[model samples]
Target: MKKLALAALVAVVPFAQAFDDKDEAIAYRQSVFSLVATHFGEMGAMVKGDKAFDAAAFQYRADSLAALSKMPLEGFLYPGADQGDTKAKAAVWENTDEFKKRLAKFQSDAADLAKSAQSGDLGSIKPAFMKAAKNCKACHSDFKNR
Candidate 1:
């Protein structure tokens, strides 16, 4: 709760600074998403039955993902952040309001998944996980390059 929020803020603030260089901003967001991907992938494995579902582990990953979901947007705020050695589509900057709406959805979806995972029932967890995963895919399709 408080600790998780504090940790997220601490971890994000330095990297997601008002960037003097666009590359730094790109790197910051990439770093945040890398962590997001790690947690999301582990949770996916459990959700897909590729890994044994450990309730505690699943909950931990979900919490981590929820916290991580809050960090990346700051990195995208700087000027020219979209023009860099990065995979972000120009639409991310050009269509800022829509991109932000998608991100807000992602944050809400991740929070819902975290809430579901906290219940420790695979049956309850699955739908929430799928919803969050779907949000991720949608954002990527619109805003990221292959």
Candidate 2:
């Protein structure tokens, strides 16, 4: 069931976008972030030995994160997306160039993680995953409110 749901998400991710409505944009980004957290956490469990490492599953999650990494940025592009029920700080919209740079780094890191996961070797995947994970912390520190 989980695999089926993830497969559905992978299929839909390329078409996902923020709506023109401010509320909808907020919802879109939040939903994307939620999915990102879910997948990232799942990978973390495998990486940290909390969960049995399934190479195939790890690769799938890494690939999903790579796809998801491309989504939230579009949601932030819509006006008023930083307002309303969101944890995104004003700096997301205020420091546009920096925000974009961080997001681009995240996207690149995610892709690298996915590529590393393809080897089905934990040694290869760990550093890539750490790099990708750092982007999350960096972005949250600079752009998201606690």
Query: Ten consecutive residues with minimal summed lDDT in candidate 2?
Result: 11-20
Q: In model 1, which runs have C-alpha deviations exceeding 4 angstroms?
A: 1-18
Model 2 bad stretches (over 4 Å):
1-20
lDDT of 2 by residue, 1-146 (tens): 99999999987867645386989988888999999999999999999999999999999999999999988887888777777999889998889999999989999999999999999999889999998888789889988899
lDDT of 2 at 89: 91
Best by TM-score: 1
TM-score of 1: 0.87
TM-score of each: 0.87, 0.87
Clashes of 1: 0
TM-score of 2: 0.87
Positional deviation of 82 in candidate 1, in angstroms?
1.3
Candidate 1 structure quality by residue, lDDT tens digits, 19-79: 6788888898999999999999999999999999999999999999998898799889977
